[model samples]
Each structure stands twice: as C-alpha cells, then as structure tokens.
Target: MLYLSSFTFPNDDMEFDFFMKIKRTCYDSFYPFKVLSRHGFERIDFEPVTILYGGNGSGKSTALNVIAERTKINRDSIYNKSNFYSDYVDMCEMHLKVDIPENSRIITSDDVFDYMLNIRNLNEGIDQKREKLFEEYLDAKYSSFQMNSIADYELLKKVNATKSKTQSRFVRNQLMGNVREYSNGESAFRYFTENIGENGLYILDEPENSLSPMRQMELMKFIEDSARFFGCQFIISTHSPFLLAMRGAKLYDLDENPVEVKRWTELKNVRTYYEFFKRYEDEF
Candidate 1:
C-alpha cells in the first residue's frame, strides 16, 4: 500500500545555502524552501494512511505540495509555485517501495470546489436548454403545416414525436439529464469516491472543506475501507477529527515547532472538540 516509503525535505541550513547562491533580488520570497524547514518538518515516514495536522499556515499544505511535486503525481488544479519551486523539489528526496501508479494523484480543495462549480454551471446550461425544449415541443406539437417534400423530413419527425409524447417526455428526450442532483457536501464526497481507485497513492488537501459532520464521517469510513481492503495509500492534510481518528493513521502534528507524531485523540483540535462537548454532556 505504501508506494512512497518516505520523503525528506530541505532543512533550514540547505534553504539558507540555496538562498545564498541566488543573485536575484527582484523576488521577495523563496516560498516552499523556507515553509516546512521553519517548523523543522524535514521528513515524513509513510503508512497506509498518513495525516499532516495543523492550523492555517502550519506547513501542512506546503509539505503535501512538495511531496506531490517531487513524486510527479497527477494533479488538477494549478498550485502556487515560486521561481525556485522546481529547484526546491530537486533538493527533496523520496524512497518508494514500488513504482507510483500513473493513476495516483493529488486532490486539492480548489479541485473539489472547481468541480462543484463546473457541475453547477453545466446544470444551469441544461436548465436553459430544457426550457427551450419545452417551448419547441409545444410549438412542434401544435403546428398545422403539412410536409410537402423531403426538405421537411427532420421537422416532420420532430412534429410526430412531440405529438405522441407528453411535454415532459418530449423535453427529456431532447436534452441531457441535470448533473446537480447532490448538494455541495454530497458532491464533494462524490468527487473523492469517483477519483480514488484501487492501488493508487492519493494526496488530499483539506478534504473536509465542503463536507458536513455526517459527510465527514462518511468520507472517513470510505478512506478507511480504501486503505484496508483496496491497495491504496493516503496522505491527507486536515483538521477534521473524523479523518484524524481514522484507524491506523499516522498523524504528524505540524503545529509543533518540531513536528511530532501523536494519536488522533491527542491532537489539540480533537481535544478542544472533546472538551466543548463534555462541557454540555447533558444536552446530547
């Protein structure tokens, strides 16, 4: 299940050396270089499921991006890349147990959001077509013009078809079905399930963004099953307790100055949630 056995990022000393070599002063920052090294997050040892847990700007996403770039995995959205991004990736290293499958990919929050937006746009277009189809059906069904020649062949067929079928059925036949059946949360969950296949390494960034609590639990179970039964591995950056609590997932606390692995229950976010609920235990 572990295609990427381990990965190493550039440390502060290496970042400093790289900066020392650079003569360009126009660029204000060398991004990914200093991001993870600042927190002493220089390496990740993989498992069936590995989680990078942290608050915003804790380098969780930066680490994932570095790994994804180094591994050369497929990704949909365009990520922020500084002028030195490639050079930074070159300094990093990865040891793989097996060849990374071509289907392996990194899924970012932007990718999921774009997917939902695309679906919404497509459905809007389809709705417009449906309205036009309805009008066409009524017009064709009521038209009294007789087909005098082969020039009217297509129109003749449409007229006959509309006459035999009801308005809804006629319209349905003319247009494709709407693809916006699911809510945003359900759509986001569906995006993961649809993209993830067996025997592939997947990196998911903040997958809990669009999901509700119930949906988050559903996604957690789905990921657990993928890793357990299917030949799959996951590297996820998330603050969701549901995902952080996945069975047998190794979690690195990026919030720590020196990143450390800890149990899901021990994470600050999870503990905060536990305390909040415990304070009002009688309500539930």
Candidate 2:
C-alpha cells in the first residue's frame, strides 16, 4: 500500500546557501523556495493514506506537484511551474519503497474543472446534432425518391429507415445521447472512481471543492475502501474537514511551522466546524 515511503525537501539552510551563491536577480524570484523555506520541513513519511492539510498558499499543493514531477507520474492538468521549479525540485529528495506504477497519477482541481467543462461541451454538441437530426429526419421521411444516382441510393436507404420509425425515434437513433446523467458532484466523483485503478498511488488536490457534505463523505469512504480493500495509496492536499477526518489518515499540518503531524480533530478547520455546529446543536 505504501508506494512512497518517505520524501524530503532541502532545509532552508541548504536552499539559502544555494540561493546566496546564485545571482540574486538572475531569475527575479524562486517562488516556492521563499514560501517553503519558512521552516525546515524535512522528511514526509507516507502511510496507506497520507494527507497534507493547510489553508490557501500553505505550500501543500506545491509539495504535491514537486513529488508528482519527481516521480514522473500521470497527471491530468498542468501545474504551475516557474523557471526555478526544477531548481527547487532538484534541491528536494525522495525515497520510494517500490517502483511507482505507471497508473499512478496526480489529480488537480483544474483537471476536475476541465472534466466537468468537457461534459457540458459534449452535451451542447449533442444538442446541436439533435436539432440537425430533427430536420434530417423530416427530410428523409418525406423525400420523393427519384432513384437515378448512387448518392440517391444512400438517400433512399435513409428514407426507408426514417419512414419505418417515428420522427422522434428517427432523430433519437441519429443523434447521440446527452451526457447529463451526472451532476457536477457526481461527475467530479466519477473522475476519481473511474480514473483511479487498483494498486496505484493517487494525489488529489482539493477534491472536496464541488462535492456536497454527503458526497464528500462518500469520497472519504471510497478512498478508505480503496486503501483498505485494494492495494492503493493516496496522498491528498485538501482543506475540507470531511476529507481531513478520514480514519487512519496521517495528516501533516502544512499551516504549522516545520509542518507537524496532528490528529484531524485537532485541526483548526475541524474545530471551527465543531464549534459552529455545537452552537446550533439544539436547533439541529
């Protein structure tokens, strides 16, 4: 279950030494270096499920991207890479327990958004084709076939087929079915359920973004089952308490200096949710 046993980023001292040696203004900026150098976030050890918990700009996503790039895993959307991206990754180090499977991948929020967008576009195209099919059906059903040419042969076949069926049925047969069965949440969840294979490492970025509370819980169970039943490993960067609270998940508090590991209930976000709900407990 553990594909990546441990990985380490260069300490600030090392990065600072490298930074001082290089031309300060040569690249203008080394973004992740500045952010990730706040503390010596040394080694990150993985379990069946390793989670990076943080607020926005906490360097969790950056860390995931670095690991994904280092291992050359399959990824859906491109991540933000600066001129110094490789320089930063080079400074970091990783140790894998076993070979990273080719099916191992990183899934970002952009990938999920694009997946949803593509579905919408496909349905729009199908709708347009449906309108064209309506006209084609009418034409074929009422065509006065004067069979004198080869092109007419195709038309005659169409006319015969169209006349045999009702207009709606003919149009339905001609056009593709709309891809609207899944809602945004359902489709987003499907992206993970379908793309992720057994016995592979998966990295999810903000997977709870479009999911409701119930769907988030469903994803949590799915991830847990994937790791427990199948030989799958997951390293996720997320802000949702629902995902953060996954049972047996090893969580690193990226918001903390040096990135300390903590229990999910101890996270500020989970505490915030707890307090809010407790305040209105009687109403619930």
Candidate 3:
C-alpha cells in the first residue's frame, strides 16, 4: 500500500509534474526523494521495512536524505543536500494512516553522539533551573512570613513543590543517558532500542556500522517486535546481510538498472559472503 509518492526535478525544473500517489490506508504521506537522476536505481516503491542495497556512491544515501528532508520524515541516512535545494525536493503523497506522532524522531550515526550530548546538556540545565527555583522559593517563603500577601504565599508553595518534583529523580537529571558512555556497538544497539518507540516510523542508515553479529540479530528482533506490536515502520539503507535478511524485509538492490526487490540470500552482498565463507568451511 503505497501512500504518498512525489518526485523532484533537476536544475530548478519545477514545471514537470512529478506523480505523487497515496495508496495505503495505514500511514502518513511523506515527501519522497524523486528519481531525478540515478545511475543504478531506476525507480523506487516504498515498503514497510524497505532496505536499500548498493556499493558506495551508488546513490542509496542520497535518495534516503532526499526522502527524509522533503517529507519531514525521520532520517538516518549519511549524506544530505543543502537547504537551497529543499524547495525543489521531491514532494510526497502517502497513504494517510496514523497521525505522525510527536515522539517519532529521526536517528543517524552522526547524530547519536550529538543527541546524547543534548540530553546531557538539557538535564544539566534543568538541574540548575531547579536549584535556582528552590532558592527563589525559599526567599519567597521567608518574605511571606514578614508580609501578608496570600497570593505570594501560594506562589511560594507552588514553586517549592515544583522544585521538589524536579529534584526527586535519583539522577536528579532530565537527561538520563549518553551514547558515548557505551561502546560503539552497544551505542548503536542502544540507540535503536531506545529511539524506536511505539507507533512511530523510524529510518535507519547503515545501522550495522558499529554493531556485532549478535547485536545485529538483536536489532532484528527489536525491529520485528516494534513493527508487530507497536505499529512501527522502518526504512533502512544498508549492506549488512544480517539486517537485509530480517524476516519480511523488502529489499531493493540499487545495483539493478531499475531498483527491484529480491530475497536476502539472492543479494550480491549475501552471495559474496556465502562464497567467502564457503572457502573456509572445511577448516572450520
């Protein structure tokens, strides 16, 4: 069920009416990265868990970024274009399903560290604010003892209660975690689990960059559960056979003239891995 579909023209060519169609009844219509000009991929069809496969510079990342920016969809792809070209970005016509949830957010390897930093900074700021408010509250209460304004007394009580709630957390911090604190592989896995919450669409770009085989499998399980139980959808771009092989994942081989779906075992990357491993089969 393709919900929304739109395309972008090259070189400020806005006259061309790119076809955008929404088919499904289960998702929002986000903008698309139009097939303005792709060398290997011919066209694209969105899927629940679409996986893009190709060698470096095959335009997989480029396409992902376009979709992300144009549709205001979650994005984790590596490369991005300048804002100057945003207006010309391909438009999206999507199957209008669920309202885009506010908690839904885009996550990328590049931003993992930055997101953690922001959380940390936000928590620190919250703490400082809480302390300052506490001091103000104390002063207000003391002033109320000498003054006779019932309104001031009420304000003082409200501020003190608010400060108490803010300081109740064991961490006394708003931001509870950081990616840098975990190993590279752990960081990636943690991000996937923590960010891919209920009923949201998540786009992952080469999530295998920092994950081990075990962790990759873990990601597969997480993805499955999220989609099955939490109403989550995924659009990923990667070369990892582990992720490509996820049950029911729709794969588009960017190496093809017109991008086409294929079984995981049939993918070039998977075949190459099979051949390489076959050589050491007897030794193992």
Return the top candidate by lDDT. Answer: 1
Two-way lDDT contest, 2 vs 3, winner? 2
Superposing every Cα of model 2 onto the true structure, what RMSD results?
2.0
Predicted candidate 3 versus true structure: per-residue lDDT over 1-284, tens digit per residue: 22222232342123133323323346343222334344434345555577888888666766666556655765543454443345445433334445565555556668766655665677677667767755655554445343358767766555555546543352334333432355667767777787778877676778787789999888888887776677777778898888898887788787876556799898888999999999999998
TM-scores, in order shown? Answer: 0.92, 0.91, 0.63
Per-residue lDDT of model 1, residues 1-284, tens digit only: 88999999999898889888888999887887778887899899999999999999998888999899889999999987898899999999999999999999999999999999999899999999998998898899898969899999999999999989999988877789998568899999999999999999999999999899999999999999999999999999999999999999999999998999999999999999999999999999
Which 10 successive residues of model 1 have the least lDDT summed? 172-181
* lDDT (C-alpha) at residue 245 in model 2: 87
lDDT per model, in order? 0.93, 0.87, 0.63
- For model 2, residues 264-283, the per-residue Cα lDDT tens digits are 99999999999999999999
| Model 1 lDDT at residue 36 | 88
Model 3 poorest 10 in a row by lDDT: 3-12
